[model samples]
Target chain A: MKKILNNPSDFVDESLRGIVLAHSDMLRSVGDPRVIVRSDAPVRGKVAIATGGGYGHLPVFLGYVGQGLADGACVGNVFSSPSADAMLTVTKSIDGGAGVLYLYGNYFGDKMNFDLAAEMARDEGIQVETVRVTDDVASAPAEQMSKRRGVAGVFFVYKIAGACAESGASLEEVKRLAEEVVINVRTMGIGFSPCTIPASGKPTFEIADNEVEIGIGIHGEPGISRQETAPAKELVSQLLAHLTADLDLVPGDEVSILVNGTGSTPLEELYVAYKEAHSWLSQKGIKIFKPFVGEYATSLEMAGFSISVLKLDETMKALLQAPVNTPFIKQL
Target chain B: MKKILNNPSDFVDESLRGIVLAHSDMLRSVGDPRVIVRSDAPVRGKVAIATGGGYGHLPVFLGYVGQGLADGACVGNVFSSPSADAMLTVTKSIDGGAGVLYLYGNYFGDKMNFDLAAEMARDEGIQVETVRVTDDVASAPAEQMSKRRGVAGVFFVYKIAGACAESGASLEEVKRLAEEVVINVRTMGIGFSPCTIPASGKPTFEIADNEVEIGIGIHGEPGISRQETAPAKELVSQLLAHLTADLDLVPGDEVSILVNGTGSTPLEELYVAYKEAHSWLSQKGIKIFKPFVGEYATSLEMAGFSISVLKLDETMKALLQAPVNTPFIKQL
Candidate 1:
């Protein structure tokens, strides 16, 4: 809660300026209320990809805007969606002759704002398509996976769709690939400690000292259930059970796994969880293409991790393997 | 403090396993010890570049190993150097036919270990070279810049040297490029809070509620001095004055600036510092090539920031602009 910020209102604006300055060679900002984008954005014949959300996730919004990822990103305040106007600016800035594709997580505020922006883009006679990633199975029943809330699985959509776009794919192809990734991906999170919002200087959720929550959302949302702290292997098994059960993953299935740490978890513990998870999947005869275990998506300083599995095929594999040069993700 | 690890001793090994599992497509362990290299390392005839250090700094030792950066990295326990055996393993794994180049910071432990490893490699009849990055102006006088401790400036060296290696440069050429980057770069850090080592479960240093320290090293090391908290602009000015005074800066010199947060500092505060720093540098007629503001190199859970300035020439500029695909550094 003791944040070194000047003012809560200026947080997003100031952070954006710094991001632009630091990555000026690779990225730039557009318009007055800046939206981040690659320095060479609006690729003449390629579909422009833009995604945005709240600002607390550093490498997510700004860090992800570089080569082989989003061409532009519109960031909102911490844990809040950007305004419709802000999205509109980003959309316009990255719209090349091939049109633009909007890819983002499926959160309530973000959904509404992106919808409004899409309508505004239509009014401006620019071709625009949208793909809302709803990959967190904890948010909905298995049969209604499309209605689930999005979490870190949105990263997969970004990777796959961005690769398609960077390869000069049409907006329709980029949107389709993004949608496919969203459908094939699933994510579930756990939080051991709650993080304090910088502006409020208060805990976002009440987590008991010795307890951990399974299936927690990234933004301090309530999870499926709470349980006592257990060994690393047991904790990973519990998470994997829920994730695999929700997706009905079977033996010999090929998937890409990600063990993402919520902000405060150390790399040491993350690796422990990954070790158990990798063994568990291997025991099930699952073929993992590339597993990413790090603090990809985080919630302020919360101590926890999330397991995301994206079932991969040849195309998804190639797209994932494509060279991506971004502040956070680097695929060679 | 209160780490989520099972045992302190297993930290590095377990974390390395998790990284390999997570990035199996991109990276793999070099040998039995704590060395990680790109899955497709030892690029035919290019100089193999390697770096290693403590494990607490994620994205620094391991996160920086990918295309356009290090060919391999050895990780030790938190805030400790890897043993010579570990460094030797990495060097052997990444030693292409062209020989190997080791680039790292100027910490005593690291220098001693790397030197021992270099000697061992030489005994094995393998060509080897080393470049110690010592760019912290706060640690040495201008005339003794080579004796200064290395910090975040090592990142610049990794980038430039990695680019040279990728271009099939000889071991000597890569070492020269890395040394040149170190000479042109200078960094100074300040700390507002101390980080707790996971093994100790307590803070590395103590600071009063109203105190901040300037010229702090990344590992919770005691800073040059402590002072009352000041405005972000004032803090940036103080740091810039100390860092830039020793370097020869004319009215219109071009430079690349990095305002790095030491983990706990919020992105918002970093931007405030960047805003003031950018304005001040521009006012001095310094042409900024690209300004980077983010948590690049961090002290675990420490609340502070560091500023690094690298005066640019055509080679430095091109290397900075080169496309790099790494977990942390992404130049597209």
Candidate 2:
């Protein structure tokens, strides 16, 4: 129940206010304060990529909006989907002359809201396309992959799609490229601690001190099972096993691994996990390309990390290396 | 301890191994494995900035070694100073024809070890200068500022000194610039929870569930006092009061604020604090330049944050804006 916030109801608005105030040069707010866009948004002839979801998972939902990233982001409350109105506002503000593309994680509430917003935007003579990131391999069986939830693997979607869109690609091209990334991405995570939502002032879920939840969802969703804690080497191997198998990865495969901290995990710990992952992949003869080891997505102060792998091609590798200047991430 | 690590003794070494593995293009380990240097170290005549301290605080000690930052760093165990031999190795590997500047926080163990290393390097015919960072306003009184512990304010030291040295400044000149930053910087922190060291599966410190410690140190050292958890506004106000007064900040002064998370504090919470600090400074007519609000330094998984204010001048402002490309940071 401990948090460094003032009024619970004002958490999202105040945080956004602070974000705009601090990063005024790179980002701005539209008529609806909940809709944030890059300062130079609506780049003429460039397909705009819009993303959004609940707050808390920073550098994810809103933190990715900037030059070389998403053109705009719709802000939502903690662990809650943004309103369709907010998404529509974002679509209207950042849609360059070309078209707008909706790129976000696959969650029922977010999908429903973005779909409604897309329908409304199309009614107003605007072209829109949707590409939901469903990369969490642990969320569903391979046959029911569509039911999987999006996780940190969404970083690849943003990197590839944002670069492709920035290249003046049409909406169809951008959507297809993003879909290709989603098809190649896979992620699995574990949770050791839970975070409390300000409004509720209650831990999202309870976990035993000596146990860890494998394949845990970002929102504290039930995973495969709770088991006694194990070394990072073992946990990383378990996650990568699910990821590599789901991707049908084999020797001679090339991939980009993102050792993402869910929240409270230390950066040093992520590197430790990365070391294990690198060793694991090396043993399997999988060449890692441009590995990202940090927090790309989070669940408030949840204490855990996830391992995400993005199978890469020459085109994806080239785009992934493109310069990106977001407030939270700088791949320059 | 609930850490994502293998053998506790191998934490620091394994993390550094992973770091070098991932950032091979930007950094490399000298003969001593514990001593890491920029991939392009000994930049002909550029003065090298050598920095190091204990582990755990990512982006602080070793994370600063890259282009436009520290030229080398010596690794140490968690919350423990590194050996003098490692520092000597770093100094020997990175010292160019100009000289070497040994810059690190003002801690008893670090000061002792670096002093010994500087002596050895001097005996080896390498020019050496030292400037210990003392920026934690909460650690000591203004009159005894030399005894204060360095905290996240070290970021300014690395930035200004690294930029100055990068410009081919002499060792003495870099030391002077770093000393100037130390004089202008002031920081204070608060903690809500404690983190356990992997070596000893016990909490570093403890407080009542609903209480918070003000003026807390990165090592879980005793702070001012514990009190009921207050909103970030009141807490930030309390921190800035000490920071501004210690610096004798005038209404027209310009400064850069670093809202630093000790470890587990969420980025959203840091921004909320930044909002309050920005408003507070604005009301006093003090202009903020280059505000950094994130995890510049951390204390394992302790849930707390610190506010560091650096009174800036034209020279420092220009230098601070210079491009920096480190493994943990990129200001390009």
Instruction: Kindly report the fnat of each predicted structure, to 2 decimals.
Output: 0.46, 0.57
Tell me the lDDT of model 1 at A154.
80
Instruction: Put down candidate 1 lDDT per residue, B1-332, tens digits, no spaces.
Output: 33455566676677677777766777888666588888888778889988999877776777778888899999788899999999999988888889998888889999999999999999998899999988777777788866788888777888888888888888888888888888789999888878777677778788887788888888876667888877667778888887677677878899888888777565556777888788788888888887776667877667778999998889988977676665544444
Scored by lDDT, the top model is 2
- TM-score of the first chain in candidate 1 relative to the native first chain: 0.97
The candidate maximizing TM-score is 2
> How well does chain A score by TM in each candidate?
0.97, 0.99
lDDT string for model 2 (A3-99, tens) is 7789989988888888899899989999887899999988999999999999999988888997778999987899999999999999999988799
Cα lDDT of all candidates, in order?
Answer: 0.80, 0.90
